[model samples]
Target: MNRRSLLAIAASAACLLSMGLAHAADQDTLAAIREAKTIRVALEFGRPPWGFKDDKLKMSGSDMEAAELLASDLGVKLEIVEVTGPNRIPFLQTRKADVVLSTFSITPERLKVIDFSAPYASAVQIVGAPKSLPLKSEADLKGKRVGVTRATTGDVELTKKAKDFGVEVVRFDDESTNMTALASGQVDIVIQEPATLTAVAARNPQRQLEPKFIFTQFPVGIGLRKNDPALKSYLDQWVKTHMADGKLNAIYRKYHGTDLPAEIVKPTN
Candidate 1:
C-alpha cells in the first residue's frame, strides 16, 4: 500500500479502537454486576426502618428489602455495603458500590453528581420539638436551637432558612445523634424524616416530641453513577412496574407499619 494510504488506515483503526474502549468503559458497572453475579448496593446501615442491622447484625430494614428485591429482579446475589448519609453518593460515584439503595432523596444538588432511578419511596422532612415549644413556623424558631443530621435534606433545608429565621443549627453525624440532642434538650428542636422521628418518639415518650411543621417533601430514588444509562433504565423500569403492581407498597408497609400513601407513589416533580 502507499505510505499515505497506510497512515490513513492506521489512524482510522485507532479511532475505532478508542470508540470501542469508551463504550466498554460506559458498560463497566452493568457488565461487572452480571459477570460477578452480585449487585453491590449501598445501604444506610444504622437508620431504622430505612436500613439498619438487627440484633444479630443481620441486614434487615426497608431499604434492605428494597435492595433484596432489586437483586432478585436482576437475578443476582446481593452484596450490601454499609454507608451513611454523606457517604452513599460518593460510594456510587467512586464505583465502590454498583448502586446505592439507601434512602437517597432526589435533590437538584444530588442530581448534578449522580443519576437516579424512578423514585421507589418518599418522605417528608418534619420539625420535632416538645409540645410546649410553640414552633409553628420558621419565624417561631427565631433564636431557638435546632438540630439536624449533617448533609441530610433536613440539614440542607434548615441551613437554608436558618439565617433568615435566626435559628442556631447543630449538625450531627447521624439521625440518632440529632434526635438525641433534641430529646435531651441539648437542642430545642430537631428536623428529621418521618421514620426516624417515629422510632425516636417510641423510645422517648417522655420527650413529648411532636411534629411541629413539615419542612419539605422529597422523593427517594436509587443512586447510580452518571454513565450507567443501562443500569438506570433497568432500575427505573423495575421501580415503576413494582410500584404499580403493589410490590413496592408491600415493602413499604412491612417497614413503616402503614400503607404507602398515594401521594408518595406519584412523582414529586
Candidate 2:
C-alpha cells in the first residue's frame, strides 16, 4: 500500500476508536456505582405503599424495600434522593440520581426520553371520589374538579380525556397534596392508584373515598438514563431473578395486599 493510503487508514481507525471510548464512558454507570460504592435512588416519599415516611419518620414502602434490595445486591450503599412526580426523569437526566424507583410507569412517551428496566411492579390508575358522590363512569365526571399528580401517567391520561368529559383537572406537585385536595373538599374527584386512595381514606374516614372507575393498569420499571446499557442489563437481570424467587412479589403483596399479576411473575418473553 502507498504511504499516503496507509496514513489515511490509520487516521480513520483512530477516529473510530475515540468514538467507541466516548460511548463506553457515557454508558459506564454500573461500573461507576461499583467503584464509588454507592448508588443514588430517586423515589417519591409522598406516595404511600410505593414510597413514603412512616409515623416514626423513617422511609417505608414497597419502593423503598426494592431500592434497598437493589443496593444490597450490588454491594453498594443506597442514597435516597427524594423526587416528586414531575421531577423523576429530570433527576436521572441531570445525574442527581443513578436510578429512579418512584412508582415510575413504563410508557412509550417516556421511553423516548430515557430507558427503563424490566417491569418490577404494577399499579392501576382510577377515578376516586367520596361514596356520597355518584361517579360510576366518565359521564358522571362532567363539571367536576379532578385532582391529579403532575406529570404522572394518570395525569396525562386524565388530561387527554378531561375536555371530552367536561372535567377540570387540578394538578398537584405530589400524591400527598393531591389526596389532601380530595380530603379537604378542594377537588370533587382524584385520579390516583388504589393504594393511595386507601391511604387517604384511612387518614380521613369521613371522606369515605372509593374507586369510581379504573383508568389504566401499568407496569412499573426502574428509570435509567438513555444509552446506559450496562446499568440497564444489570437491572433487567435483577428484576428477573427477584421475580422468579418471589422476592419482588412478596414486596408487592406486602404493600398492595395482593400478589403481582400473573404476567409479571411469569413474563411471556
Summarize candidate 2's per-residue lDDT along 154-215 as a digit string, tens digits: 88888888899888889999888898889999986899999889878888998888988998
Model 2, position 71: C-alpha lDDT score: 97
TM, every model: 0.90, 0.93
Task: Report how far off residue 151 is in candidate 1 (Å).
Answer: 1.2
Clash pairs (backbone) in predicted model 1 = none
lDDT agreement with native, every candidate: 0.85, 0.92
lDDT (C-alpha) at residue 94 in model 1: 75
Residue-wise C-alpha lDDT for candidate 1, range 1-269, written one tens digit per residue: 89999999999999999999997786677778999999999988767788888889888888999998989988999998888888887787777898998878899999988898988888778888878778887788889888888888888888888889998888898877777887777987888877788777788888887888888888899988887778888888898899889999999999888877676676565
For candidate 2, which ten residues in a row score worst on lDDT? 135-144
Clashing pairs in 2: none
Candidate 2 Cα errors over 4 Å, as ranges? 1-19
| Predicted structure 2: lDDT | 0.92
Task: Give the distance in Å from residue 220's predicted Cα in candidate 1 to where it truly belongs.
Answer: 0.6
